[model samples]
Target: MADIRVLIVEDDPFIAMDIESAVADELGDKAELIVVGSVAEALRATASRLSCAFLDIDVIGGKTFDLAAALLQAGTPFAFVSGSSPSDVPKALRQARFLRKPFSTREIATFLLGAISPLKPRRSRNH
Candidate 1:
């Protein structure tokens, strides 16, 4: 299988580490995880190909709405992992999945699994 590039945008170190660990455990060697603490860093990370992303609503630079929009435009799948209410996410981006704060590792794993599954066919096509 092709490497699954995963982007994680979160400001809290503990939460970021937790998500990273969960992703690592879930994807094992097939995933390339990039964890960033700010919207700027997250935006910069988007210069390359990403199979999927997990974003926190509030980051160092700002809310992730712009970054989310960019990812959507790029046809990359992403989900919001934030304590904020789902209503806080604009209606346009509401289609993306939302995982509330204090989420479990199981939740992260499930999201990753779902996100990467749809990309497998695309990866096969590319090869």
Candidate 2:
């Protein structure tokens, strides 16, 4: 719903910023963006009714798939973003939206808007 928020799980500082900018550019003050680099940080941030998530398939210091599973178990919707190929995502996250690296801001923004919108699909085209 409208109360839902976004949580971004990315290990790379640069990538995280990119994701943040994309979301901010589109949503502006419409939603909140929480960025965490590791699994533990993600857990703490995920302790709410998250609208959706933009998660990296591989984190520098933790298992990205674990984070995804935890989010799913918590009943939160999520999308997987990665610099690598689709094969990089764990089996569980394979069903979620897969965003390749070097994605456009418009693509990520659209995905966030669509994901948060109840009537929209959870996935979108690769950018």
Q: List the candidates' TM-scores in order.
A: 0.90, 0.81
Candidate 1 residue-wise lDDT, 53-125, digit = tens: 9999999989999999999999898999999999999999999999999899998989888888976645555
Clashing pairs in 1: none
The candidate maximizing TM-score is 1
TM-score of 2: 0.81
lDDT (C-alpha, whole model) for all candidates: 0.91, 0.79
Please give the distance, in angstroms, between residue 14's alpha carbon in candidate 2 and its true position after superposition: 2.1
**What are the per-residue Cα lDDT tens digits for candidate 2 across 1-127?**
3455789999889989999998888777767788888887887887767888998876756667887888778767787888778877767667877888888887787788777778344566775
Residues forming the 10-long window of minimal summed lDDT in candidate 1? 118-127
lDDT of 2 at 120: 41
